[model samples]
Target: MSGDGIEILRLGARGDGVAADGLHVPGALPGERVRVGPAEERRGVRRAALDAVLAPSPDRVAPFCPYFGTCGGCAIQHLAPEPYAAWKRGLVVTALSRAGIDAPVAPLRDAHGAGRRRATFHVRRIDGRAEAGFMAARSHALVAIDHCPITEPPLHRAPEVARALARPLGGGGKPLDVQATATAGGLDVDVRGHGPADARARQALVALAGDLDLARLSLHGEVLVQRRPPVVPAGRAPLVPPPGGFLQATRLGEAMLADLVVAGVGEAKRVADLFSGAGAFSLRLAETRAVHAVEGDAGALAALDRAARATPGLRAVTHERRDLFRRPLLAPELDRFDAVVFDPPRAGAEAQAARLAEATVPVVVGVSCDAGTFARDAGLLLAGGYRLAEVVPLDQFRHSPHVELVGVFRREGRRRR
Candidate 1:
């Protein structure tokens, strides 16, 4: 572990130098040296020359989870905060660059502390009790915990109830994920029975509902009390979200997003917000212009309706709950808008990109999480007579590889295709 000289494993999907050892051995990262193997074993699984993995930090405060080393959930926890911050920033810039979009990622922005408003925790019955924790990396295993270092404080108290309910099910207890959402009212937990929550499981969950100071309670996948019904941010109307709706993790994140959308869209009067879940961008866009929000989920469309009614600023939000992937917006449909502000899921906006390329719309603001998908879709847009305009990366999750970014694109003259 001397001067940054080490063998590289496979390049990360985004090209970060992966460890040659194929494991994050407690105190190592990219740019530090790690001694590998017993001679003959070193030649396994094609290697790269990124011999610069990093070593652990002095303030590396031990990760609390027992499964930290094996769990795939976090990769850079062992490194010092300084390097991990850089890695988080890297995910954004690299993703934007690969998409060939205009990303002005000069002064990287970082959001820290305990403001993560939502987290989905899986629950299971250990020996005689239920254990609750996050899903380990890519596996079904739950990383059981007493406290999660990264979540808001209230979340730590939830496991107490989770374990009590899990105690009865014992070895046969089902697996469930608790989504603690920070709504306008307060923190609401919606429980979805993922693996094996049964009719017998209802009582435990009901008791759990009584223990916490939750605004709303849900058990066995059903809403129990209307302590605080879901609300669309703009409107006072109740938002009936899709079964697994996506909600922003923080109020700051939501407000910042609205600001970015308003700034990016400029003065475009007619616009489309694709994958418009509860009108995250569409509702914001409605402040200045009429926006057509497109999504496939019926519940989300209902939420969109509720939001518009409550917030008059978003009165112009019209929704189409049609699956964009199956039936893309036609050329006639495209002609109605001058721009687009789309925030698609990690899958990226393949179908919408196809239709937008043929449109007269001049601007497209894309917010994406998956790097490869963004690049692929961007390539399609470029082929369709558009050029990358600007890129902005969001570091919402720290000490982790996952990053969010916004890429701005504008229509250019056609050439090849």
Candidate 2:
């Protein structure tokens, strides 16, 4: 295929370079000229494979990781720091503008302290050996790796551990996913994609755990061996999260988000934490104010309750397990709380936001990972006469296109049409 020289204009949401004619070239940076292969239409956009960089951009820098283009984990690592931060902050501004909102967005904050504390490794068999690593970009093929540079020191050897654990379950003849989390005790691991283990397999796993010196090991949420509790620190309390449960990517990221939440809920006596997982924000808020944490996962809620009960000097901390998507807390129940803090998944809390719009809560703080959904929910709150005070974007997952944000809204007056 003949190559064509295309001038890169800007970056798309996924970190791909865009041309004036809407052509997307992978691995190309803005303000550069790149040679690309034959173009093909994909999902209503023209895309081409980057052959070579004829003229590199001034912001381009050598990637630190060896698996820069191969591994699907990090993107936009080649761009300089200033441009990278600008692009990340621009994502929030663009999303809010599209949602018809005009709010002051703070600069992107760096929260990638000590790198990621948790990671999931994909295991697969090739030519009679089990290999563990991340998948290729936009491909199902595995890119076997020895170590990942973006993870914390404790998780540096997670790939090796995942490969060893795959041996017990047919040497990864079937697909397997190993999730490793670095805790205060030791490495907490969970294996998935295999059915229940029998007596012999379970015994082998227990012995392997002993050999690996793992704090806890589980298969599909069933404990195999627990030498010590995998305790993770949240505020003043310690929590033992459930097997393969959700957690913030980095330790510093969680602390930064919790700080913002506490500051946003200033002077509020009663606070309600929605979608509170393992009491990341609730436990911190309970230091002074009474907190009522509501979540869908019973195990997570149980963990939060245990942490709250075990910790001393905390205020009244209560919890309830309910799916907010199906039935959000109505205005009557929400009116009792002075403020509401919700940190939801990528889907955002549309139902709960609608209900909060109807309530008279003085303060509402939203924590989200998706800018588009956050903007949509912010619009809903604005329509209900809530004024968006501030929106702060945090870069927890460094080098990735993803970003996390926190938005504070205050009720201006009565509900508007």
Candidate 3:
């Protein structure tokens, strides 16, 4: 512990304040003098807990959420809007600079419309009753809450629903994860962590779903009860996503990303949507151009196919179930599409990027939630003769360190090889 408070130099990737000596202080803002306890090294970085803020930064503001500090869900709720946007945008700029890719990074766009539509609440038996809420910051300890303010208004009751759902599976005995998604029909919930539910547990869950008037309830993707299909609208199509399916955190975030993707595709007659999840982009793109949606998840692909077939007036929407990581679409396979749009997981589409690098795809749009991985993949594309056009950063996960980005690339001349 330093007798004199340490000065915070900058914000780290994980929203922690970094001192000049490389000490990472949690809950400390840049340009602020913060007193921290003795540092301990974790994951190669020396970290300390912020004990006091001797001098507060101008960018610091009072957090709106009462549970902001205790809950692990949000990191930078105290930062003012201007500096917060700059910091979020800087994430993409810093990442691209580190990757040695010189590109025009746009300002941060707020896509957190109506807040997050989906949230995962951790359920555990505390004292005598089942409690549902988020985990404490940097700890496994649960912070029970009545509701989360950052979520959509409909999902404010998600914590209560999660608590009720956990009661059937021996609420006090085992820990459970309740993933709730606000859909058109109603709340779609999926419970995990508990093993296979027995006949009695299944009956209890089904009854509870009926009582709660839930759209659907599932255990590990297996439907326990479905009062109605959990439909989520993507553009003009109504999609019933698979149980525990991956979706953009916010409805507006999906639309924003899809808009960027469609605009990047331009006048392309054929497009390939790689790593497409439940046709978030494919169904939308299919309205104008022929789309070939490729994904590893069969359930997601099936949902996309069903939605596409049910919706009229959409151009041909073909799909394929392929593990892109294991076997990326080769150069020859990619030749048929005029443009390629890939929105991979946090790991990014390194293998697909390699293949796209070899291919002569006129236009390529890469959407990623991880800036570091996006920058790395952009480097591969740039090395393969693709000119980095523009990069847009979107803040969908408000008050959090996570930022989504969409990068546009165009093939210039020939490949380096």
Task: Give per-residue lDDT, candidate 3, residue 101.
Answer: 83
1 or 3, greater by lDDT = 3
Which lDDT value does model 1 have at 241?
54
TM-score of 1: 0.81
Q: For residues 1-417, could you state the per-residue lDDT of candidate 3 as single tens digits?
A: 666799999999889999999999878999999988889997899999889999999989999899988999999888899988999999999999999989999999999999999999999889988999999987899999999999999899999999998888998469999999999999999999998988998999999999888999999999888899899999999999999999999999999999999999999999999999899999999999999999999999999999999999999999999999999999998988899999999999999999999999999999999999999999999999899999999999998989999999999996422
The digit string of per-residue lDDT tens for model 2 on 1-417 reads 435577999999989999999998878999998998889886798888889999999999999999989999987889999999999999999999999999999999999999999999999998899999999987899999999999999999999999999888989998999999999999999999988877888888889998888999999988888999899999999998999999999999999999999999889999999999889999999999999999999989999999999999999999999999998999999999999999999999999999999999999999999999999999889998899999999999999989999999999987422
lDDT of 1: 0.64
Residue 71 miss distance in model 1 (angstroms): 4.9
Clashing pairs in 3: none
* Local distance difference test values of all predictions, in order: 0.64, 0.93, 0.94
TM-score of 2: 0.98
- Model 1 lowest lDDT segment of ten: 38-47
